[model samples]
Target chain A: MHELPILRSIVGVALRHAVEAGASRVLAVDVKVGELRGLDAAWIQSYFDFVTEGTPAAGASLRLKESKALFRCRSCGATFPPGPHAGGDVACPHCSSKHVELASGNELLIESIDVV
Target chain B: MAEIRTIDIKEAVLSENAGLADRLRRRLMESGTFLLDVMSSPGAGKTTLLLETIHRLRERGIRTAVIEGDIESTVDAEKMAAAGVKAVQLRTGGACHLDAAMIEAALHELAPGDYDMIAIENVGNLVCPAEFDTGAHRRTMLLSVPEGHDKALKYPLMFTVVDCLVVSKTDYLPGSDFDLAALRAEARRLNPTLTVFEVSARTGDGMQGWCDWVADGIRGVADARDGALDC
Candidate 1:
């Protein structure tokens, strides 16, 4: 549902960079998305294609790199993937402490753009 | 022909909106107004809960305003205005969530200086709204009894981002199989610092604590501003 708006921003970023770099056209937009974001990469690509029409990024391919959600244990200072904690209890793998902080996973960024 | 080249932009997709949201937060704080963003799935009793909260805040003499975000219709905003509090309705058309620019426009109409606090009822969604920052001082979400305990697992991002969680519609808890403990545990796992409140706007169960929390937030902002002025 929100893919359009999200793609709009992504295309905006890619185009801005391409124009700033004096590129005539954008070839591809690389995005780093966290698993926790739950965004469908295919949906984003379809919307990107629609919104970027008639723009410098019209034919750009959207390449998404997904990152896993990791939790950092406050007690042990160890970061581990959330996959290991599928038991409903997200305890630290190193120290088994319940006191853990989400270190990363909510990322949504335009990593780079291939242009000419 | 120009050769293909890769440019490392390394920019967050929502950076522009985030920058605007941060600036809005600063501007609201400087005006001594605290903004709270309330989010939840539809029919989670956000409006009812907020109506009760508004009544309680009024009793405490805390001037408050509301910004209602909906995909369509002004029904919620009208209800808020009927309660005698200043209200603004943002129609997002087909957008799933409200972003900083929308909130900033609403605040312009609100003249937030007159209010101690402003509460924004975000569009009913468990996903998209969590992705956008609305420049609110705090973010809270409601999960009704019927929504089930599995929501934390199903929508972990929403549970992770919110500062507070209100388990609304507790009046139905008696006949339902809603496992409050499991929900709490799961939510806490996602967000250890999350504040949980079990409330039923209809029966008024646990409204005091929630209302008091809101009132305290309002006063805290006012007090902080006063302290800043004194310094």
Candidate 2:
């Protein structure tokens, strides 16, 4: 999976950062993945385990925080969470208009790393 | 005895990929190739449309090559090559999408200055591909008639980021229950300036328009680069 390479790169960067910060071993790595990002946490963890082998973060734990999809209605000017539906139809709770634009939930970030 | 300290290193997992994509953007601009990245779901007829596009561009004497991204196998690349164009396949092993670094690597393997246009056919995934920019000058997303018209709303990012929307499989419009008006409305709602095209790659209906757009984009790139050289 492309996630294997991408996760490898992420862990490499994190390990470098941890070592630079005077950490002997990274205890944990916290990452935030958005609901719409379509990243599988289990796969990412498995890839992390493979990539972190022989490094200071070899046995480090991975913590994933998934964010839910949220949207902002342009016509109603109201922000609401995305409903579990296939179509992009989101009735504005305020104006009942179905013209909503996504606001968040596409985030992919390494929130924090516990090292030393 | 060990000292345990919890450190906060808030960084993006895609930071490296983003950096590599930026590098690719610079390289593509410098190489004077107008890159068009296309994305859609499996069986959306992306390859079929691309074949027709390549044929039309070749007829007009435009040098073009394709970088095909797929989870596995080089079937699409082989198809492109058979259609008389340079095609490179970047296998993602099992990844759902392509990234900048992979494209950068593929670019190094190919002759960069040999083509005027480079079409990067991203993996058949609507969500992840939209998040990663692969140094394309323009992004295009295809939504076939059978795929339903609600795609724009369901995957807003993909629709919003694309400069053009190709409503493929127009021939099936009569038999299929696709709401053409709703699809156009939703796409325009997400991207007000998106150019929409309705075509059947099999019938060659809208190939000319797509070809003309590519020509214009290539000329624009050439003109800008020549002007910079003169300066």
Candidate 3:
């Protein structure tokens, strides 16, 4: 997972934001990560705690919101949400076509950080 | 009592790495250099295939250099040096992937004027290497037949991000239960524009196609810079 580096950046960004806001401590970080991004939210929280130790972001919890991806069927020209059984092996449900394209949901963005 | 507030920052997770990569890419464009970032799992024949490509290109008057990334050894760099190319070794001491910062450091050590293309052989881990942008104009990956076709399905991110996927070790096609068609289909399903070549670096099978594809990337970079100057 790239979470170690990404979470470390998150901590840095959170602390910077907290300082800019004149807050004494950071409480939580809200992030929007894609469903297919392959990051473990629980692991990110644990790592964030460990990495942020001595910083303003110490003890801050990571609040993750999984953003689901959209798939477009290249065969039938249809767009749909990637269902539960979605992956390389998955086909378009509407047309049963294997030629599907990932339209969105590879994003990993920091929405906001709560600070006090 | 302290004032609590929520700061809206909406920045990308890998922005730090991507920012460095952008600088490197700009430098490469200005210098008319094409960098190929190659990634694969350990023992996917990345070294062998890359060495062979270096050899072939050298005979045709094209100078190529390498930046080899490993956990902690000079073995691969030694091999590249013996092959008579300018080489730089980046020993991460234990990191699984090579980030743009590492590339920036290595590029400083490497003589940019000495080569037309710099092919970076990233630390051999499919998962983590794909996540970091190493400032390459083109990104490619190798998946050996021995690794099995299910790899693309399992490691979808790797398959999704790569520009090309070389199905290596085609010489062992008879021994392994590798389904070529299914693997190609699966990879295509993930990334429609991914160019694939079934290659056997040991036997020199399918090397020409790989070379041509790489030449295209090099030429594209060269032509783009020239076109910009013309405009």
Best by TM-score: 1
Q: Between candidates 2 and 3, name the one with more favorable TM-score.
A: 3
**DockQ values, each candidate:** 0.60, 0.34, 0.49
Interface RMSD of each: 2.7, 5.1, 4.2
Report the lDDT tens digits of candidate 3 across residue range B124-185. Answer: 88888877888999999999999998887778778878999999999999967898888877
lDDT of 2 by residue, B22-105 (tens): 777667667777788989999999999988888888878888889999989999999988888788899988888887888888
Give me the candidate number with maximum lDDT.
Answer: 1
Q: Evaluate residue A58 in candidate 3 and report its C-alpha lDDT on the 0 to 100 scale.
A: 79
Candidate 2's iRMSD: 5.1
lDDT at position B182, candidate 2: 79
Q: A8-102 in candidate 3: lDDT tens per residue?
A: 88788778878888889999899998765778877878888889999878777889998776778899988887444424355777888878778
Cα lDDT of model 2 by residue, A1-116, tens digit = 55765687679878888878988898898888877666778898899999999999999999988887677878978887755433434466789777666676767778778887
- For model 2, the stretches where C-alpha displacement exceeds 4 angstroms are A41-54, A68-103, B1-8, B59-61, B70-75, B91-96, B150-161, B182-195
> What C-alpha lDDT, on a 0 to 100 scale, does residue B165 get in candidate 1?
95
